[model samples]
Target chain A: MSSEDLETPKEKGSTGEKQASEAPKPVLSSGSFLLVDYTIRIKETGELVDTTSEKEAREAGIYDASKLYKPRLAIIGKGMLLKAIEDELVTMSVGESKTFEISPEKAFGQRDPTKVKVYPIRKFKDVEAPLVVGARVNINGKEGIIRSIGSGRVQVDFNPYLAGKTLVCNVTIKKIITDDKEKVQQILHNRLPDVDIQKFTIELAPPEVVITLPEEAYLLPNLQIAKRLIAKEIQENIQGIERVKVIELYTKQT
Target chain B: MSSEDLETPKEKGSTGEKQASEAPKPVLSSGSFLLVDYTIRIKETGELVDTTSEKEAREAGIYDASKLYKPRLAIIGKGMLLKAIEDELVTMSVGESKTFEISPEKAFGQRDPTKVKVYPIRKFKDVEAPLVVGARVNINGKEGIIRSIGSGRVQVDFNPYLAGKTLVCNVTIKKIITDDKEKVQQILHNRLPDVDIQKFTIELAPPEVVITLPEEAYLLPNLQIAKRLIAKEIQENIQGIERVKVIELYTKQT
Candidate 1:
């Protein structure tokens, strides 16, 4: 394989035709960092479940300003994605596209009749959301959907929101991260999913991986545990990294 | 002046006689980190109020296991020491001991009879401590001392505890830290009073002072603000500290 074939997807423009006809796909494996674009939908009602494509998300009325719109990072066999998608990813290659259907059993699980329960309206006094049908609520730690609210009573379904429904998922692998440092950072970023990975400035120096965390993450719950876990994971997954030095800079503005 | 005079209090064994008779005490000034031993008592009753010495605390039946029985840190002109004591510290030299009395007006302020109020015993149900006389309680954010509890009524005195009494304060300056980095650290330590400053591993590197925080401090409230303040204080107080880098390590046990 030529080095040109190994170039990042952005730089290797219009390689699609050559990739489809001439080039052989690389055998992707566990811990591989794949930048993938995916669009999920409910096959029965053709409703958009989720999408990495900004256009599709905007069209489906699920566009969020806070969300990253580019190709999503999916680490193979690391559970950065659904088990079903990860399983398919291990068999596929870079630049490959696949469409699959996940049954209810493999998704959020089939809905159970026993999961539904009814409680008096007074029981929801502490709930901040209005007592209306279809509003989600958590009563005594059990997450439920308010199925009906009438006769001074509320019926809640404890089943997961997507239970009993099959989902159609279309995915395209855009690029595979090859650099060792970038790969390690993506894993740490996955652990701190809320913060952008780019903000976690990481530098590799043979035995030490020095990472300076963003100031905002200084107060994150279990941040210490997360840092240790990030270090441990990097040492275990990436070769030659004996130490992971995590620096938290408290700027003037905090 | 002997170099031995600059040694830590732990190493200055039996220098009391020599210090008293021979050595002209070095002048002290503001922002000096002094390790001071102190004992406070109610002048009228001779009741032990507080003491730094373990022997005195044990004798007074106020020994606490969680407390570090050592000379307390008193940063001159800093609020870490009481304003009255700080006012005295600037004039007092090292290795000197003094006993002084502060009146109610200079202490917690004179007792106000109007500050006392009578309330029904039911008002104290939410108070965890028993509503006994002399018990301290805080209601609706206002701290008050329970003066009497009888006949279905409770008399609460909202005046300061030390009000209407004079306190006898005895203090001895044990040692004064003179190292620039140590001085900055003591200042930071004063801000984070709950945790020992020793755990905050600090290394001075010319323009940069790198501090490694203990993992336990990761989840502290307003930790980000605290860190920023620490860095800002160090830079502003210590010369040549152009940068302050803080590191937090999370171990396997988290």
Candidate 2:
């Protein structure tokens, strides 16, 4: 093959997709940072499990002002989103919306018989909660529900609430991020929930990005760990990125 | 003053008790680090609120296997212990034990009438807990208790449980810490719960202490914050300490 053919392949697949027809479809990979909106439900009972849309949550009688209702940016294969959904997105292109059904095994795993155990009713003495069936109870920090109660015995199923249920999810990939700065910011936002990501200044130095934290962020607890996680996120997700230098400036109080 | 008198002043009450009779009584200072075991009781009801002794906790019917029953190491001015008790400790010596009663103002504060609010019974629709009087309920992350129930209205008191109650605390200073290594370790234990403090090794180099973390501790979440807090604790409590270097060595798995 001529040099033109080799050059064409690089140019066509490269980030600057000048030739739209020749460019490959933007397929999601393991560490792809994606902005997505999704709604998850129990396939059998049509019960809503979770949703990113505020309108859907209000209609389903599960709206909470504390919860953020917006398109979530998540790294595909890091268990930020469900593994089954992540697997399905690997073959899909950007802006693709699909309704898919996930089996119990693929979703939360099948219910195990060993997880259901009967214990003396006195075990829940500290738990002032009612022992009614289907009511969730926290036993030794592990949350479960009282499945049955009789003869001073309470049957508690430690299995996850959705363990045996099939999940039906309607997921839309709003955008597949290619910009390194946005990816870093997304990762920073995910790690440091309280700090405003937009306030921090990021400067590109080719293989490294210097993140200068704002004055307000200097006194934040666990800031060093946040910086470390940000560095790790940049190293793993962004291509050709090697180093992340975080500068925290502390101005003396007057 | 002569050089001998100036030298004598430093040795008078600074870590040594040689001139105990000549000098003033050795009183606890604000920054003093002490190993203490304390028992707190409600003065009005004579009900035990807390204790460091396992026997005391068991007798009070409030013992938990999860709680660490030991003399806690605390800095006097930091409010690690009760502020009222801390004030009493300022007058105490190294090995002194004192039983004192603290007023409601000095203890958990007086009960405010404004904190008692009447809400509609429908406000408890989300709460699965029993609507009985004195039932603790968490509303918007602040824990409160139901006080009364009338026609369509339920009264909830958001005041702290100990509010309006005077506290009688029996406090004993077991030992005053002088060694910087033990001081650092004690601070580490206080900061990082569950992790074995013995695993961390501290090497003192005047104005700096290097803390070597074990292999298992390298992966512990938010270790940077723990290290930062350790440094701050050492600097504030221990004399001549400035810097704390935390080294995490990762060994190659063969």
Candidate 3:
């Protein structure tokens, strides 16, 4: 697709069209952090599968609940995870926690049957197994781990998870790192490159931090928050800066 | 909880404990933006309800195919949306797209009678008349927008979806933004705090970016990849910097 075709309308303020006066961006100077804790459950069964409560996780582990192996964590705006999660994380302040249920429509998604394929047992030449029904096996040449074993069909579903399971994740915003804007941007980009730092800005306010992007970078979808997250990190690490403001200077289109 | 009680064995690198030297830590830095064009047909009747084609959506819109309003967008790591979508998003990369079909069990999930509640029409005093059977109506305070209006009793089910329905979503990876270290920590804390920027280190290797945290921050889950993302982002914006590193000189007990 041509670059022009990819450009969508910029996200306007919630009221639409009316530009909200830019408020004084709170600088998250050094020593600002967000602490968050959460639990994840199956939306259908309401069964707890994951949690940030290490103590509860340990307790569940004692009961042999392998679900407690890890708890979900993320830094707001860093793009280390999902935009929705980061959006929620950035909205929270210290010591504040909330639980929201995500639908299968919104959470993971409806399971796809095409993802479930029946492979022959010979595919597992190296894999040793009792190979009984309901047994889990590994696919030697596939992206997913085996979920179930069936009749001679050897149903080796490629999806990492059983289709149609709704997942609930409880997240706690533990701390927000506001310093090192440039570094935070590097983290989000996954590589250090030659770009103008002046092109970025971070504004920390309630609910989320706003990162303005240069016209050249605007085509990157969901990148607005990614920039804001980096700025938030710098504001958090630097002293006296309540928030990081990334101002993307207009650059000639490449 | 006592400080000692809070101290727990770090699960980092546990997945490959046997191959420690070559084993990359499970940084969990998976994130992707996907745009999928797909169609959903009932498993039993083969009736198409949802599709990526706008023409199809408009046609299906005429029916009670509430399933096709929004295209599925899954953000993996953060778990902000649905678990199934998140799982799929995590494993994908940018510029990649796929179409798949999900079973009812893996999509909306099996219908639960317990979730379906019957209420009285008096409860909906504000509702307009002509509440015929099969007509949708709102229920007491929940604002379901109505599923079906029944005799004497209103079968105002709370589920916003038609249970046991199969859905298809065509997903495209728009972009993948990895969380930076400082931001990841802030997300954990829920607020941004000013801190010594030198404390955290960022590494950009395969699987994800790694953030080496001080002992005080060691207990922070998913710290490694968060740092890597930050480092990668820094590398992108700064000149002559291939990678960003975080080093801690002192430690404090939280």
Candidate 4:
């Protein structure tokens, strides 16, 4: 600021215009790995379905301390988000916030009548527990809920809970992650949300990332599944991250 | 009384020879899925290493009646067996038995000295139980055993227990499974050894095989993993069976 002010000597014709034209800002594109915070709701009722922002969560009376509220990693054109949201992200720049309305068709598909069926009351007798009218039941490997039961017959609906609902989404692109280490950490956090993300430390050498897991994450059930899913996400999202080594160090107690 | 005894006298000269040449016998190939019973030992010490035959197991004082003693499915060239054994099986036929020697290099590779390391004794003090000389310990995600403890230093050897040992294997190909139904049942039996194989009823309509799981196998731990492994084995072994449906039926108790 001082250099420009001293050179102009209080009389600048087009100095501000020239500086703006010298550098261009970055824009998000397809295949870009992004960190964003979003809040999704039902368009008709304005009911909050999901959100990544803690402030919005508290305002809606759905705040949970156990759930981490942080910027999420999203890969464009990966179908991770709705197709409408992915299509809109291409024209977005960093730090921009937008609200978009998604129709029912673009959101969950329309509910079908065939998804609702009737079953015999005897089917629930084998279950060890009593069946309620609205409780979900798995029959013959298919999941459905009991809608009504009368006269030795039961009615069940197999449609998705959110089918035939329009969505309203408010999103903000926080930052774009160009570093491989951060990308790998974000993907690992996505898979293991219960673990504190700050405890992880990542070392990056091209084509190899070594992640040091915390002591709390050692005894997690299905640890191999988590490792496999994290590896898949890292390989799919981050370039040059072909090999992953998860290290767990045990130290002597003092 | 017999067909050969009742044949006409005019065709007696070449009838027996002609019948033998009309049918061809089956031989195992690289991709053939076989059910075999084998016993493996260390050639130098005559120590029993492994066996799949009940008689051999009983003779070696390792028989467990709870363990299933049926033939095991081994896919040739799939690294299910040692490379030496796999190479030798291509020339084998059904009902044939062979004893072959496998050198240490061809089996588990020779032991390396660099894999053995000496750590301070205090490193093991935090372990909940007392440390023994030969107890296996997991150190930083790598499994190793305590080889020796002397002068406040503990020596841990990371080599496999069977490393640097030559193996002598006696194998007999009981049957080569060519039927899709039998192949599916064998794979299921391999996954769920406690359940009776006869309880599994398989219906094979090309590209789809339906297996009905018995009541005993319904509550098994990790049922999804068993199903996935069975599906993978069927797909990898049987060419035409693509879909696998495992049905578990539950009925009301009297």
For all candidates in order, the CA lDDT equals 0.78, 0.77, 0.48, 0.74
Using TM-score, rank the candidates from best to worst: 1, 2, 4, 3
- After superposition, which runs of candidate 3 have C-alpha atoms over 4 Å from their true positions? A1-33, A46-49, A62-73, A129-136, A143-151, A176-254, B1-254
Cα error, residue B239 of model 2, in Å, equals 2.7
Stretches of candidate 2 exceeding 4 Å from the true structure: A1-254, B1-24
Candidate 4, residues A1-254, lDDT tens digits: the string is 12232211111254666657854323456667777779999877788888998888999999999888887878888777888887777667666779998887888888887999987888787764357787878877877778888998989888876678888898877776666677777787888988888888888875767777776876566755776677667766677667666655333222
By descending DockQ, how would the candidates be arranged? 1, 2, 4, 3
Q: What would the C-alpha RMSD of candidate 3 be, to one decimal place?
A: 32.1
lDDT of 3 by residue, A92-191 (tens): 5544466766656655567787887777767766776556654555665555545566564566666545246766667754444333443344343431
- In model 1, which runs have C-alpha deviations exceeding 4 angstroms? A1-23, A53-70, A91-97, A112-140, A146-157, A184-200, A214-222, A249-254, B1-25, B55-65, B90-95, B112-140, B146-155, B184-201, B213-226, B249-254
Cα RMSD of predicted structure 4: 22.4
Docking quality tier of model 1: acceptable
Query: Scoring each candidate complex against the real one, what DockQ results?
Result: 0.40, 0.04, 0.01, 0.01
Encode model 2's per-residue lDDT on A1-254: one tens digit a residue: 23232211122254554545574653567787887789999998999999999999999999998677767887887888888888877666666789999999998999998999898988988887887998899988888888999999999999999999999999977766777788888777777766776887887775777776665765576766666667777777787677676654322222
TM-score of 4: 0.46
Reference-based TM-score of each model: 0.76, 0.49, 0.29, 0.46
Give the docking tier of candidate 3.
Answer: incorrect
Docking class of 2: incorrect
- Candidate topping lDDT: 1
Worst 10 residues of 1 chain B by lDDT: B5-14
